[model samples]
Target: MAIASVATEYVFSDFLLKDAKEPKYKGVRLELALDKIVTILAVGLPLFLISLAFAQEVSVGTQITCFTPFNFSMKQAVYVDSFCWAAVQYQADNSPLWLHKFFPYILLLIAILMSVPAALWRFTGVPYLSSDLNFIMEELDRFYNHAIKLAKNLATLDDRDAEQDSQSALDLAEGCFKYPLVEQYLKTKGFSCGLVVKYMVCQCLTLLVLLLSCVYLCYYIFLASLVDEFPCDVRTGMLKNDSAIPAAVQCKMVAVGVFRLLSYINLGVYLLLTPLVVLAALGPARQSSSFLQAYEMLPGFGALSKFKPIYNDLSIYLLFLKENLSELKSFKCLQVLELLQQSAEEGFDTMCVLQTLSQVKTDVFDSQKMGSITNICEMDKPKN
Candidate 1:
C-alpha cells in the first residue's frame, strides 16, 4: 500500500508536468541545437582546413621539379622528374632538391575546386530561406487579424441574436478554414507563391547538385591528399624508345592541399545552407499569415475579383494595350475614357495609354474641331 501511494504520486506529478508544458507556438525555437552545432563543426572544419590549405598553396607554390642539365633534352628533364618523384619513399630519406620546384599551383587548383560548392550553396540556398520566412511572417499577421475580427464579433453580439451571429461567424470560420487567410493573401499578392514554389524547387535542385558536387570533391580530395607528389609515366605513345625520357616524372601538384581545404569548407557551407533551406520551406508551410500577407496589398478585392495564379497577367496586358494605343493616330476618345476609368481599375494605369491615344488627331471628325484640338495638343501623326 505504501509503494502504491508513492507510485501514484509520482505518476500524477509526471502527468501534471507534461500538461503544464506549453507548446512553442511561433518562431518556435524548434531547431535541434545539437544537430546545428554538429553541422557547424562538420561544415566549418573542412572549410577551415580548405582555407588553410589554399593559404599554404598560395604562399608556397606546388611544382618544384627542376629540368635536368641543359645538355639533356626535354625528355631527359621529364625523366629526371619522373625518376625522382616515383621514389617519394626515397626522397623522404634523401630530401632531394627537385621536390621543392613545382608545389604551389597544384594546391591552388585543389582549393578552388573544394570552395566552389561551398560558395554556391550559400549564394543559392539563403534566398530560399528568406522567401519561406516571409511566408511565415505573413501567415502570422493574418491569424492575428482573424483573431481580432472574431473578438470584435464576440464583443458586439446582441443576446437575442446570439445564435444567428454565432452561425454567421461559424460559416465565415468554416469558409476561412477551407481557404485559409494565407491562400487569400497569396491570390492578392498576384501569384507570387508560384515564385516561392519555384524558388523552393530550385533550392532543392541546388541542394542535391551541391551535395553531388561535394561527393565528387570528396573522392578527388581523398585520393589527391593521400600523396600529392606522384610519378607520371610519360612513356606512352611516341616516347617509347626515348632513352632520354625517364621511366616516370616526379610531378608534385601543390593544389591538392588547397583543394582539400576548399572541399571541407564547401561541404560545411552547403550542409548549413541546405538545412536552412529546408527550414525555410517548412516555415512557410506552417506560417500563420502566409495567405493574408499576400492579399493585404489589395484592400477589398476579395468579394468580386478572385486572385489568379498569375497576378500580373492583367497588368501586363494593360501595359501592352497602352503600348499598342500609343502607336495609334489620336486620343480624343481615350481622354474621355481615362477620365471615366482611372478611379476604378486601381490598375491598367491608363495615363500613358491615354496620353498616347490623345496624340491621335481627330481631324477625321471636322476641320474646326481638328483646329481646336491642334491648339490643345500637337498631333504628330498624319491627319486623315
Candidate 2:
C-alpha cells in the first residue's frame, strides 16, 4: 500500500514539478523558413522602394518641371511647376499623370496588400498549428524518455538480480501498460481539415495578390512608356483671366524614371513569389505519404499506414515532423525502439509489453527511478 501510495504521489508531483531543462513554449517555431523569407521579401520590398521614391522627391525638391516663358519671372517658373503638378489630372487634352504623382502611395498600397496573406497565416493558422505542435512534441518527449528508461530496465533486470520478486515486476508492467495515450490522442484528432483549409487559403491569397499586383505593374509600365510629359493649362480657377499667362505649358514629371524602375523591381519579385507560394502549397501533399511509408518498418508505425489519402490531421502532423525532424529527439528515440524490436525476436512479446507500458508509465509513473523492488518494499516497512 505504501509503495502504491508513493508511486501515485510521485506521478502527481511529477506533473506539478516541470523539468527545468524543458524548453519554453515560445521557443517552438513551426513556421517554415521558406515562408518567413517569402513574407519578408513580398512585404518589405515595396516599402523599401517607397522610401527611395520619397528620397528622390526630396532631392529634386519637386515632382514636376515646366518650361516657362522667358518674359515670366523666376517665381512664375516655380508657379508653373506647382500649378501643372496640381492640375495635371484635370487637363482634358493631356494623358492623366495622377499615377506618376501618386507613385509612392501606390507602392505603399501594394506593400500592405502583399502582407495580407502573411497576416492571415499568422493569425488564423499559426496559433492553431503552434499549440498542436507544442502538445505533440511534449508527448513525444515523454514517450521517448519512458521508452529509453523502460528498455534499459528490461535489458538489465535479469542480470541485476536473480531472485527479484515476480509479483513486483508484474505490478510494474501492469502499471506501465495500462494506457496508450499518444495513439488515443491522435485518434481523437480526426478529420483536421481545418488546418489544411487555412493553409491553402493563405497560399491562394498570396498568389492572388501577387498576380494582381503584377498585372497592375504591367499596365502602369505600358502607360508610363507612352507618356512622361504632357501639356498643362494652368490658367484655370483663380488665374483664368490672366492674359499674360501662356495658354498651356509643357510640363514633365521628374520622377517617372524612378517610378518605372521601382515598378519593374516590384513586378519581378512578385512574379518570383508566385511560383514559390504554389510550390509551398503543393509540396506537402506530394511527399506526405512517401515519407510516412519510409517509417512503416517500425512495429507500431502501422498507425501511419492508415494515412493513405494523406490530407488528414495526422498526416499534417507527420509533415511537420518531417520539417523539424533534425531537431526532434523523439524521432531518434522511435528509431532506437525499432532497432530493439528488430533485434530481439524471441523477446518480442516482452518488447511489446515494454513499449505499451512506456506510453502510460510516462504519464502515470516511472518505476525505474525507484531502483528496485527491495527499495520500494522497504519504504512500506513499519517503523518502530
Candidate 3:
C-alpha cells in the first residue's frame, strides 16, 4: 500500500508542477489603479459627508431654534418655536440663504453627479471592452499553441531528410505567417473610434462635474458663513391677532456650521482629485502609438513570434486537408468536417475548405448542402 501511494504521488507531482508553471493571462484593465482609487474617493467622500451631516441633525434633534417671548405660556412658547421653525424659509430674503435649508440634499446630489462617469463606464463600456479584449487574447493564445507544435515537429525531423523537411516547414511557416487573425481584427476595428471617444467623454464629464461642485461648495461656504441665523415672523394663522405672542422671533439654523465644515472637507478633497482626474482624462493621448505596439516590442520577439511554430503546424494541417480532401474518408475526416461546420457556425473563416469541397462536388458533398452551409457561414460572420 505504501509503495503504491509513493508511485501515485511521484506520477501526479510532475503533472501538478507543470500545471502550476503554466502562464495565466488576465486581459487588460481599462482603468488604472490610481484612476479607480480617485474615482471612489471623489464620488464617495460627498456621500459620507452627507450621511455625517444627517446623523448630526438627528442627534441634535432640531435644525432651527426659536427664542419665544418670556410673557407667553409654555404651550404658546412651544407654538412660537413650531411656527417660527415652519416659517424659517420665509425669513430668508435671498436665494443663497434659502439654499442653506437643503444643504444635505445638495451634497447628496453632488455625490450622485460625481459618480455618473464611473457608473457609466461600469455599466456600458467595461463589458464591451472586456469581451473584445478576451476574444483577442484567446486568438493570440491559439496562435501561440500552434507555433509550439510546429517547433516540436521541426525538432524531430531526421538530418538525412533535412532539405525536404526544411522546405515543407518553410512553406507551412509562410502560410501560417500570412493573414494573422488578430492583426486582421485590429485592422477591421481600427477605424471605429467609438470606445476611445466614449472613454474621453466620460473623463471630461467627470472633470466638469468636479469643477462645478468645487465652485458650488466654495459659494455655499461663502453664503453659509454670512448668515447661519435669521429672524422669523411667528404671527401667522391662529397666532395672527394674538397680542400675547411676539410678532417676531429669532431662529438660528442648527446644522449650518456642520454643513459648512462638510463643504470645506468636500472642497479640499475635490481640489486634490482635480489633477488626478485631468491626468486620467489625458492618459490615452500620452500613449499615441497603436494599441498593440508595446506588446509587439517585448523581448524574445514577443507573443506572436513565440507562437510561430504552432502557426506553421496549423498551416501544414490546412494544406494537407486542402490537397487530399476526397482521399480522406475516415471518421477523423468526418470529425474534421464537423469541426469546419462548427467553425463556420461560429463565424471563423473556413472559406478555404469550402472552396476545395466545391471543386470536388461529390455525392457525399452535394451542391444544395454546400450552398446552405455557405449561406450559414456568411450569415454567421460578425457585422462591424
How far residue 223's Cα lies from its native spot in candidate 2, in Å, is 2.5
Worst lDDT run of 10 residues, candidate 1, spans: 11-20
TM-score of each: 0.35, 0.75, 0.67
lDDT of 1 by residue, 1-384 (tens): 465335434432322212115321233222233324434543445555645655675677533364344577777676655555554544433333232232233334434543444454446643543454345434534443453345345334566897899789877765665556544543454434443454345445545654665565566556545665555555657878878756655466555455556656565666666566565444334333222222332223232133232323222222222223322211223233333343333334322222222333333444454344334333322257
* Per-prediction backbone clash count: 50, 2, 6
lDDT of 2 at 103: 81
Q: Model 2 compared with the native: what TM-score?
A: 0.75
Q: Where is model 3 poorest over a 10-residue stretch in terms of lDDT?
A: 309-318
Candidate 2: worst 10 consecutive residues by lDDT? 354-363
lDDT of 2 by residue, 199-274 (tens): 7788888888888889889988887545878887877788899998888898888889888888899898888888
Could you give candidate 3's per-residue lDDT for residues 50-93 as a string of tens digits? 78988997899877777777777888767766766666566547
